[model samples]
Structure formats: C-alpha cells, structure tokens
Target chain A: MGELRLMKGNEALAEAAVRAGSDGYFGYPITPQSEVIEYLMAEKPFERTGMVVLQAESEVAAINMLYGGGGTGKKVMTSSSSPGISLMQEGLSYMAGAEIPCIVANIVRGGPGLGDIQPAQSDYFQSVKGGGHGDYRLPVLAPASVQEMSDFVPISYDLAFKYRTPVLIVSDGLIGQMMEKVELFDQMPRITDKEINEKYPWATNGKPKGKERRILTSLDLDPHKLEKHNFHLQDKYKQIEANEVRYELIDCDDAEYIIVAYGSSSRISQKAIQLARAEGIKVGILRLITLWPFPKKPIDELVIKGIKGFLAVEMSAGQMVEDVKLTVRERTKVEHFGRYGGVIHSPEEVLEALKTKIIGG
Target chain B: MSEIAIQDIIKPENLVYEKTKLMTDKTLSYCPGCGHGTTHRLIMEVIEELGQENETIGVAPVGCSVLAYEFMNVDMQEAAHGRAPAVATAIKRLWPKKVVFTYQGDGDLAAIGTAETIHACNRGEQIVIVFINNGIYGMTGGQMAPTTLPGMKTATSPYGRDIATMGNPLKITELVAQLPGTYYVTRHSVHTAAAARKAKRAIKKAFQNQLDGKPGLSFVEVVSNCNSGWKMEPVQSNIWMEENMFPYYELGDIKVDGKLLSK
Candidate 1:
C-alpha cells in the first residue's frame, strides 16, 4: 500500500492527476465537481509539478483547451457535471475525430436539463454511447469508490494514450463528494516531448529538422478519405471491445440471479445482495468497471452458466439496461429498477426490486 | 528589348526576391484569385523574416483554409469550428516561448466562435489572431457571414440580406478592439501590391509582438475577397471589395499598445 490518506473523491482525483504526471487541467466550475478545480487551485500543481491549471470561461472553452493541449501530445484532463458536460460534447466530437488523447471526468448530477445537484447515473448513455455528432467511441470508466476515483486517473490516461482515444471517468455526486481512505499512487514523471514523439509520430509539437510537419486535424474533406478514417476508428473500437471489458463479480458462482450495477448503485447492490442471500435468495452482483466496452463477455458467460435473470440497478430511468438486454439477447430476462431526478435507491429498495422484478416476475 | 543571358537572370545579385522557405512545395488549395493564398504567403513570409518557423505554432480554423497546415511549413493544430482561440490559449500557456497564432475566417471568428474570440482577447492571451473577413462562408458554399454586408447576396441570402430580421453584419475586429487585454488591433487588406505590403507589415508586427513576449492579444484582420463565393471574376471581386467592403471596413489601426487609437 502507498500513502494512506482520507480525502474526498474529487480531491483524490486531483491528487492522482498530479501523481500521474498530467501536464494540464482546464475546467469550469459545476456543482458536485467544483471541488476538483478547487483542490487543484489550492494545491498549486503548477509550482509543484509544473502542471498548467486553468479555469476556462466555460465548459466549452475547457474542453477545447483540452483539445489544444492533447493535440500537442500533452497529458491533459477536465472535470464537470451533467450540464457542463453537455456543453463539451462539440469539443469531444472533435477530439474523437482527430484521434486525440485526453481524460474527461463527468461527476454526474441529475439532468435532461439543469436538473439538480445530486448524484445520478443518467449520463451513462451520453458518455458510453457517442455524445456528440459522429461515428466514434470513448472508453467510459465507472468508478464505484473514492479509491477507484484516485486510481482511474492514471489508468484512464494509460488507456487514452495506448489507443489515442479519449477516456471518460463516469462518476457521480456521491462518489465525488464522499470522503474515504485512499492509497494514493507514487508520482510518475510527466512525459517529455521526445517520449511523445516516439509513441505518437502524429503529435503536433513543432516540426523538427528533416521531419515532415505534423498537422493535427480531424477534417477530411474527401468523402473517401473520411470513410477510410472512420473504418480505422471502428477497427480500433472493435479491438477495445474485445480486450478491455472489465467488471467485478461477487457471489456469482451458484447464484440463480445477478444484479448489474455500477458506481454508487454498485455500492448499494453489494448490500442488496447480502440482504437477498439472507432471505434464501441466491443473488449475486456484477459491478461494471468499464461501461463503454460493456462487460458483455462475462455476462454472456454467466448466462451460459445458467443464470436465470438479471436486475439492472441504476440512478437514472434505466439507461444502461438497453446494453444489458442487447448482450443477453433473449437468453435470459433482464429487468431494470432505478430512482430518477437526483433520487438514490437504498439497499432495501434494491433487494425488493430484485425479488419483485427478477426473482418473482 | 535587350537580350539578357539566362545565367545573368539566375544570378543572386540580379534576383530581386524569392519565395520564403517557410512555405512548403505543396500547391495551395485556395480557389483562383482567392485572397487566402496571398494572406497565407504573407504570414509565411513574416515567419521567415522573423526566423520563427521552428518556434511557432499555428492554429488553423475550420474553413476553406482548414488545410493551412499543408501549406505552412510549421507546427499546426486544426481547431474545431470557432474554437481556435481556446485552442491557441492552451498552446500558448503550455509553451509560452512558442509564438502561437490562429488563422480564422469571417464565419469562424465572427459568428460561430464569438465567445472564444471575446474571452481570449479579454483575458489577454499572448497570441496572434489573423482574421480573414470575406463577408461569406466559402467552404460551405457562399452562406451569409456575420460580416456580410447589408443587401449582400449569398447562398442563404438569395433575396439580399435583410438587416430588419436577419440582423446587421457584425464588426468583430472593432468588437475585439474594445477588450482591455488587446495590445494591437488592426484591419488591413490584400487586394493590391500596396495593400499586400501593408498587410505583410501588420502580420510581421503581430508575430514580432508574440516573439517579444508582449503580455496582450494581437489581432490582425484582413478584409479579403472571396471571388468564387461572391460570384465574380477574381479581378472584378477585388474591384467590388475596394468599392464596397473597404468603405465600411476601413483599413486602420483600431488599438495600439493596449489603448484604443483615437478616432
């Protein structure tokens, strides 16, 4: 274990960014996630790690700044809530189109509009699916705990640079505001231009002598060329789907039913599974870690092992259930139970929903 | 006519001027008689004159000149439509020593990216902004621009632009000049040889301000002609622009050294 410290999830994320050697963070203030920028400003990572921290005029400017920094092959990140993330969709599409690498953390609050400043998982569809206009994909990581909030910063950056794709951390108000003991990782030195050039020859750092100028752009005017680029992106997504699906299974073996959940819902489901098992119900929990490349293979294998039903617990009006239903493909019944508009479901509620929807119905 | 030897013409002493090394050999994608070619050449010439090719980073806007990276032999990042200032802001902040500039068109700078343009200038970001005002969208096929003159015909404004409902054209260069953080704000043109020389000087001064580590924004707006979009011969478009556009968008310095030039 590394240094053990009690910190808020948002603070832990900021600390993790510093330790992970992020070169820049540009963000605007939004509820349930304002602590991210607050912590960065207090820490002054600029003096300590030479990281550039800027409070942009809006989420629009913040994300575009990420595009600029990421285009130069620099490790950059931004954090926002639902409404703020909505403003960033345009820049996200551009980054995806240009194949730039950066991390975005969405500390989700309830919304179709500026709903409320409470935890909600409603943004799952927007983040996991393409939120912006275009045929594109980003690895969406759901952190269920304050520790993973800290841990996923570096992991997301690794996955981001590994594939030259944006990686999103799908958190919520609960995880962002809650304080927990976390083992912070050791510092990793910021990546240098030479290292970036070695890995990404397409990075838009200044053109060196004898090297061709590197143009960082997503605009392919010719339809044929654009189509070719789209194909390449699709291939990359397919590979990610094949290799990067991650989840945690608790009491899965010999269980008749499984509860699929993530983030705060995962925490609630853990307790629900305990209560359900005590009531002679053979229930297990499948906690999703990566939501974009939805852990389909494991769920498929679980179904193969004769699991009869799945209960999807969410903080939205059942957004991720569609993905679960698609993966199950009529082999097993999949039901959804959720609390919408900033409301959270408790363990008792989840257990009753499982018995009523999955086990009984 | 007196016969001159080929060798004499090729001699260094006889050569008056040559194209700058800052331009790549790739053919420019601008349409025939388009001002973008002249503007692009002037910028490259400025970069060459200052010897900042290796130390400069250009942010290319999403317009006809989106492929400017192909022509300018320097580091470039193609920004999303109207996001060049935010992009340039980050690049300049990260690498403060690098001379960063954004080349944008009328629709890109004035209409779609108004917020970024204002905030970046307001914040005094040390970057050069080369705004090309053609009064119409060229890449998307002659759509009305925010700078489009009243009663100007465009693909979108078939019956001429109506200021009553369609709104009056926005003068963004004058708008930017109002910001406290701008060190220099000027509007020039590239229609004739004299105008081209003046435009080149403005561009050189803009780049020099960046190299000199000036603490404020430097904006250079070039009132250009879009022959194809304007539905006129290249030469005719120049005549049209000089007659109509120049009067409204007069060539002059709006701000100098963080102070608005007295009218």
Candidate 2:
C-alpha cells in the first residue's frame, strides 16, 4: 500500500512481481520492454527477496526458463515485444497444452517483419488467438494504461496459478514507454506454496510424496490419446470463454453509435466517447480486457440494446473485427477501421471517424 | 558382491516404470542411430539410481528434444528453442529444493538459446545442463547447426559449410567452462562403448552436482552424429564422430570440485 508514485509501465510490472514474492524472473532484453529487465536489475530483487533475476541468452531461453519454473509450481515471468514474442509462441503453446502456470508480457510493436519499436498493438492475433503452433489460447490481458500494466503483473500471476495456464499481459510500446502514476500494492499478507500445491496436485513440481511422478507435457501422438488431449484442450477453452469474458462499456446503454477497441485503440476510444458526448452525439464504447475470450457477451448485450452500429479500431488490418462480427452476426452494421504495417491510429483520427459516422448519425 | 550391496543398486530397466512412467511412455519420434534415445536412457538411469525420479525436473529444449518431456521418465518441462537454461533458472528459483536441468541441442543451445545459456552460466544458478551436439538440425530437415563441421552441407548451406562464410564449428563445452559460475563442464561422445560409458558418467555427474545443492552450472555436451541426416551408415557415423568431431571437441571433465562437493 505505498503512496501513488510516477513510474513507467514496464518498471511497475517488475516491482509488482517482486512485491508478490515471485521466486524467479527470466527474460531477454528487447526494445520498449527492456525497462522491465533494467528495473529488475536495478532493484536487485534477487538479492532482496531470493527472486531469481536472470538476463537470458535470447527470448527463446527466457520463455523456456518460465516453463521450467512453472513446472516446479514456482511463480515465474518473462517480458518482450513483437519479434521477441514471436519466438516465445512455441514455449507458450507447450505451457498451455501442459497446463503450466506462468506470466508472459508482450509490449507489442508494429510487425510482419522487423517493424519499428514504436507503439503498436499489432500482436493482437499473436497473443490472444494462439500465436504459436497447435490449437491453444493464452488468457490474454490487454492493458490500455500504465497503471493497468502495473496492476496486471500481479493479477497475471494469480490468474496463471488459478488456471494452471500461461497468462499474457498484452500491451503496446505506448503503454510500456509512457510514464504514469500508480498505487503499488504491498506484498499480500497471505502467500503460500501449499495452497497451489494442494490445489494443483497434478503439478509435476516434485514427486508428490509417495505418488507416481507427474509429467508436464502436451504430446499425445496416439490417434485416440491425442484426440483426448485435443478434446480436453477444447473443453478448457470453452470453460475460459464461459467464465472469463471482460470488457469496459461506456454510455452504450442509450447510444446509437458503438466503437470497439482494445489496448491503445481502447485509449483512443475513450477520447472519442468524450468528444461524441460533448458534441451531443450518442457514442458508446466497448473496450476489451480479456482479448482471447473476445468479450463477445458485452457486444451481444450492446447489440441487444440496439447500440447503433459498431466500429472496430485496431492497429492491424481488421483482425479482431472478425470476432466482433461473429458476436454481432449482422444484427447491426459493423464497420472496420484499421492501420497496417507500422503506422498507428491517433485519437484524432478516431474522433474524425466519429465525426463522419457517429456525429453524423 | 555382498547381497546388501547388490540389492541396494537398482537396475536401469527398473528405473522408469510405475510412478516415473508418467513422464515417459513407449511412444518415440527420433530416427534410428539417434543418440537422443541413449542419452534419454542415461538420464533416466541417473534419476532412478539417485532416487531423484520424483524430485528431479527436466527442461526439454526445441529440436528433436522438444518432445523430451514426452519421453523422460520424470516431471519434465518443455522450453523454447534454446531457452532451456532460462526455464531451468525459473523452476530452480521457484522451487529451490527441487532438482532442475535442461536438455538442449547444438542449434538450440549454441545458436538460438545462446543468450539464456550464457547468462545462466554467468549467474551460476545451481542447475545442470545436458547439451547434445549432433552437428545438424533433425526436425527441420538437415540444416547447419552452430556446431556443424566445416565442409558439412545442409539444406541451408548445401555446398558444405564453408569457414569463409559460415565460420568454423563452435566448441560450446569449452566456451561454457570458461565462465566462473560453471563448476562442472565436460565434453563426451557416444560413438563407442567406451565413449558411451564415459558419457554416462559425465551425465550422472551433472545430475549429482545439482543434487548436492552446489552453487554452479554443470554442463555435458555429447558429440553425436546424425546418421540419417549425414546420409551415412550408423557405424560410419560413429567413426565420423570419432575421427572428425573429437579432434575439434575434446572430451574429459573440464572442472569438478570433487573435494568441494564432487561432480
């Protein structure tokens, strides 16, 4: 419960993990997200709390380290941006299939190649829709502000343990590079390994007392056995979809215009909402938190309320709009707004779109 | 031999069944003459002998060993391409009392995972590493590995890896041993019975160091040949490893604090 202090999003996450009594942190330093590593190094969380702060040889090594830590039922985390995150998808997929718990943070940037290191939420599909090979989904947390980045660090830790699956803190260079005030929570009074151990007895953490050894893996090569595993994976995804849809709704209850956005775009949507309100035009905004589950229920609710039509704002070319359309299902006119390659959309641009659409409506 | 002594020692076949079976089964995907099978057996033998089958945690790297978790008869974690060291660091930190090690290939360990491997060695995290140097990529078809010999050809470098362009092979074992944090570093091959026996001992030593709660990095790089990828017979591949590979990557325990803790 420390007083509010100005801090960078990446640094705040590093501090939050330290406060949560994490035992290990493994990561390769990448742009924008490098602050997370730098902060851990400066704080020497390893020396202070027996937290293992290791600068990995590459992003590949850092994520694999997270897999090791999670296998042992330890709290582990790693951070990277676009290109680095792409390398981690393999390990992340394995974690999901094996049901290992860990936190992976991606401060995304423009991509498709060696995209610039500026702010871009281009990794939206890579993070939420299973960036890696195989059929899997990471419970993605999209944080729009610097404060959410700090708060989500601990929350991701909790979610990983709760779900026994990898949790992603999907932000952008904008959030990681921006500075803002945040209230850092003191270490929770109650923290123990026994709780997770007792709950997740299946954890290969160690040989369970006298029980048989547990294996942390997702391979089921046998046609029948592999089908069972795939079935189980699909069932888990269904559970997640049923239980974990999250979003922010603004003024959509009585509005004719609905704007859909997330991460940085969501930040712009908030401004658009303000502008629309000031102009006496009714504009409701829906910002997604759980990007993978897609927050479809909220959109369905919006459609039910007859909240005008929908406008999807994203850094990439209309990727998430697919899910938005599926949710609305032609019940409303769903328009698409996207910026591809490296360019990012501005709040002004969103406002201008609103002027052309919502205000005009 | 005394009856007590004989009874105390467990056999290799009995090492992996029953409880530790959870981590491994009959399924396999490695090619014939692949030393990965033998290495996997050796690790299982060590775990069973030390009664660490339960407490031991193995981190599998990308490559042929990516599915190592599916075969190792213990609690296993799959790491990204070369990031076994990083994953091992996290597991060790979270569960300090448990034993942790990473099984990696030349490409995964020497190339893609070099960052995690180097830093883990630098910090001296008390973890063991099993480095497999087969000289070529097995999963993505035959490709030049970081340890690929000069004049070796792969799909990427079809005209044999020219030192002028691709550079000479890297001796990762010696490179890692140079770090202060590395306590036990060795280079061994499974080319012959004698070499295989020696390689087993080296792998056991690496595992033992982690168990002794020693503070350092222990690594063993096995110089193995890829018969299918090399397009050579199994026996010829072994000879190739002995003649061409050994001259470059020498074998022996580089560092062992036997008196300090052994291994």
Candidate 3:
C-alpha cells in the first residue's frame, strides 16, 4: 500500500516515471498522449526527483534523445501517439541495433495515417512485428488498466536494462484519458553517476580513468560482423520468449470457448465473458500482458484441454487474430471481431460476436 | 649528410609532435587526404588538452565520418544520418556536467538533419556541434548535398547543379548564427597549415565554453574539401575549393558570444 490516488492513465504513467527514478524523459505532444508530457511539465519532476523532462522538436528528435540518454546507462523514456511513433521508427531501429536500453509508451490512436484521436488497438502488427526496418523485435507490454499503466513503468525499465534493449508499453485513448484509482509505487532514488559506471561498463557515459573507451553504434559495415550481431540479437529475443511470456486467464477452467484479447480489448472481453456465462455459454477471457512473447504455451494448454474455438477481440480490423491462428494452427478454429476506425465495441456486441463468430459459427 | 640515429630522433626532447593519446590505434576508414582525419585529430587533441578526455561523450554522425567512434576513442555513440544534435542534446541535458559534442557533416547537419540542428541550436542546448562542410556527400559516392554550390557537379548532379531546380546552397553556419540560442558560431577552413591552426583554435574554444558552463550551444563549422568525391587530385581539389568554395562559404568568425559579426 503505497500512496493511492485517482489519476488518469497518462498522468499515472508520468508520476510512475518519476517514482521509477527515470533520469530523463524526452517527448513530443500528440493526441491522447499529450497529457503525459503536460503532466510532467506541470508536476516539475525535476525539483521532486531530479528527472529531466524535455519537449522535443518532433517525435523524431524525441526518440533520438532517448538513444543519447539511454546510451549513457540512464533510465530514460518517451510517450507518443500513433503518427508520432511512426516518425520514431528509424531512431528506434538504430537504438535496437545499438542495443541501447530505454522505454517508449505508445498511447495508440486510430491510424494508417492520422486516423483519429480515439482508442484503438491497431498497432498490434507494428508493436509485435518489427515496426522499424531490420530484423529486430521490441518487448511489448500491453497494459489493460490504468493500474497496469502506472505499474508497467518500472517493469519496462527493468526489462529494458536487463536485456540492454528497448521496451514498449502499448495503451490507448481509453486508458490514457479515463480516470481511475491507482496505487502509486514509492519513489526510488535516481542512480548516481558512479553506480552507472559500475553497473553499465559498456555505457557511453565517458571513458573511465584507465578503462577502454566505449563506442555504441549500430553500424558494422563488415557483413560478417553484422551477421554475428544479428545472431546475438536473435538469441536475446529467444530468451525473452522463453522466460517473459505473461498473460491472465479468467474463468478459463471450464471454458468451451475463449476470447483472446489484450489491452482495452481484454477489459472489454472480461465483461463480454460475464454476459456470455449468464446466457449459459461457457466462455472465458485470455488477457495478454506481454504481446510480443504472445503467451503461446497457455493457448496451447487451453487447446489441449479441448477448447472448441477462440474469438480474438480487438479495436482494430484484425491483427492479433493472426498470432492466435498461428498459435492454434488449425487445431481449433480462431476468428476475429472488432469495431475499428476509432469505434468502441460494447460488451453485448462482443458477446454477440463470440456467439455468431465462434460458438454458433 | 650526417646519419641520424633512430633513438636520437625519437628522444623525448627532440620529438616535436605525437598523435594524441585520446585517439585510438584503430585505422581511420576515411579516404586518403580526406579532411575528416584532420578534423578528428583536432577535436581529440582539444579534448585531451582540456583534460576532459575522460569526462566527454561524443555523438558521431553518418557519412564518411560515421566511423569516427572507431578512431577518436572517448566514449561515443553513433547517431542516425542527421540526428547527432538531437542525440547530443539528450546527453548534455541528462549529464549537464559532462562535456558533450556532436560531429556531423553537411548532408547530416544541413540537409536531412536541418530541423534537429536548428531546433537544438534554437533551444540553446549546452553542447558543441562540430559541423564538417565538405559540399558533397562523400560517403555515398559524391551525391549532391545541401551545401553543394550552384553549378557544382556531383554524381546526382552529373550535368552541373541547376540553381532554379536544385535550390541554392544552404549557408547553415550563417543560418544558425541568427538563432539566439547559439553562444558562439564560427566558420573556418582546414586546407592549409594556417587554416588548420585557426580551425583547431575554434574547436578548443567551443569545448572550453561548454566546460565553463556557457549559456548556449557552440557551433564550429569547418569547410573542408572532398577530393575523391570531387574527382580531382588532392592538391587540385584544395586549389579549386579556395577559388570557388571559399568566396561563397567564406571564412573566419561569423558570431562570437551570442552576437552575430557584421560583414
């Protein structure tokens, strides 16, 4: 029981960043996520926790700032919406290649290009798949509630530093704008410069007295060396997949049908599950906490237990359904349901979708 | 002539010059006679001379100097094409006490990275920006760059640059000097011994300003020649640059202590 407060998802995240002992935050304002930087600016985290907050010229500059700060073995973060995150792809790729540790929170909006400033879980492909060019995958954490939004900040930093890789927290307008009770974590002191040198010897802070100079760059012009680096990155992704898969199974023990979802969709499906059970349908919800490591093992276990079908609910046209299908592999039928283009689906709509698309279909 | 002993010539008192220890033993990837090597040496020398060798972090930009991290050797990070300034901005802001600088070329500093460069300078980021203006994109086989002079020929401008179609060459040093955030802005050349000395002095001053906790960004632009990119001999390229490039780009201080110098 740390301090409790009613805070918007974006505000909670900003407060959590300060409490997480973040050294710096560089971000550009975007709809549904602008509150993040606005809150940080108004709160004056620099005075309270020595966290440096800057409003960058653009999302492009913001992500590069993360690269620079994170390369120095500092815990830094940034938040943006869809279009802004798209502008950040190149920097993110470079950071991924260079193995810099940082965190990015994408408060998703409807988009192919400037779609709308409403809730949408449409970036599934971009988040799980490599949004940026090159062969790299960022660890994607999908926070379904405002509480998870606040809690995921420290978890993201921990995973980022542990793997020496970028981590992403994907939420949306619903969670970002909605106010909810959040139990805030206690403030952790920012790591001292000496501690950073000791912990991250490879960081590009400065050359220690007699130590070898450090160089952090993604460019290895030699084909063999680049290939070797790629192999090393792949090995890291494999380890993350093996150990970091996270999900929550609700009322899944006696489920005949399961609704697979994450983020806001998972929250909606929880309500839909309750409705379906009231109507004598044995449906359960599978809420993914980590979108990247996809939680295939749990899905496999459900399939082995004779679950008939899966309905992948989302706020997109149908993205995560692909992953669910790939994991189910025709052993069971998997279908997709959603109201896209910034439309929010109701619990009744989800229940109808499950009955029509999976149970009855 | 008397035979000189190797030991005598290499003696401590007899040695007039030696490579700065700040630079690593790694071989530079720059082409023969490229000004990048000279500029790299000058920056490292300044850092070493200031006793800030272990207290500095450098952001290396893309282009011929993308491999600058391999040679200069202090803790360094390689930035994307034109984002060195943005990268350097975060480093300096996070660790205000640490000496931070960005090494960028014309294409990186003036063209693709113009927004980052301008905004960083405008925001008065407390860092040094070492801009290398070589007129053409040397790393990508002589492509037309933002700083490419009118009528100059490059791989992309095989028939000579058409000013109306290609746009006028950007005088970025002059452009940045107009910004209030810049504490010191200067333009120099490194083609001759005297020019190299002046350029070295400018670099040292820029680094010293950051160490002194100056209020704004320090910019040092070094107009250099790319002989291989220009498809000319090293000597011919230097001579051509003096005749054609110097009159347009000019030389000497453009701004000092946040005040623009009058023509």
* Top candidate (DockQ): 3
lDDT of 1 at B73: 87
Put the candidates in lDDT order, highest first. Answer: 3, 1, 2
After superposition, the stretches of candidate 3 with alpha carbons farther than 4 Å from their true spots are none
Worst 10 residues of 2 chain B by lDDT: B254-263
Tens-digit lDDT track of model 2 for B23-68: 3666677888888888887777777877886687788877887888
On lDDT, who's better, 1 or 2? 1
- Residue A165's lDDT within candidate 2 is 90
Winner on TM-score between 1 and 3 is 3
TM-score of chain B of 1: 0.97
Higher-scoring candidate on DockQ, 2 or 3: 3
Order of candidate numbers by TM-score, starting with the best: 3, 1, 2
Q: What's the true lDDT of residue A317 in model 2?
A: 82
Q: Is candidate 1 or candidate 3 better by lDDT?
A: 3
Candidate number with greatest TM-score: 3
Error of 1 at A68 (Å): 0.6
Each model's C-alpha lDDT? Answer: 0.93, 0.81, 0.94
lDDT (tens digit, per residue) of candidate 3 on A1-361: 8999999999999999999999999999999999999999999999998899999999999999999999999999999999999999999999999999999999999988999999999998999998999999999999988899999999999999999999999999999999999999999999999899889998998899988999999999899999999999999999999989999999999999999999898998888898899989999999999999889999999999999999999999999999999999999989999889888889999999888888789
Off by over 4 Å in 1: B1-8
Expressed as tens digits, the lDDT of each residue in B1-263 for candidate 3 is 99988877787887799999988898888877778899999999999999998899999999999889989979999999999999999999999999999999999999999999999999999999999998999999999999999999999999999999999999999999999999999998888889999999999999999999888999999999999999998999999999999999999898898888889
> What is the model-wide C-alpha lDDT for candidate 1?
0.93
Models 1 onward score TM values of 0.97, 0.84, 0.99
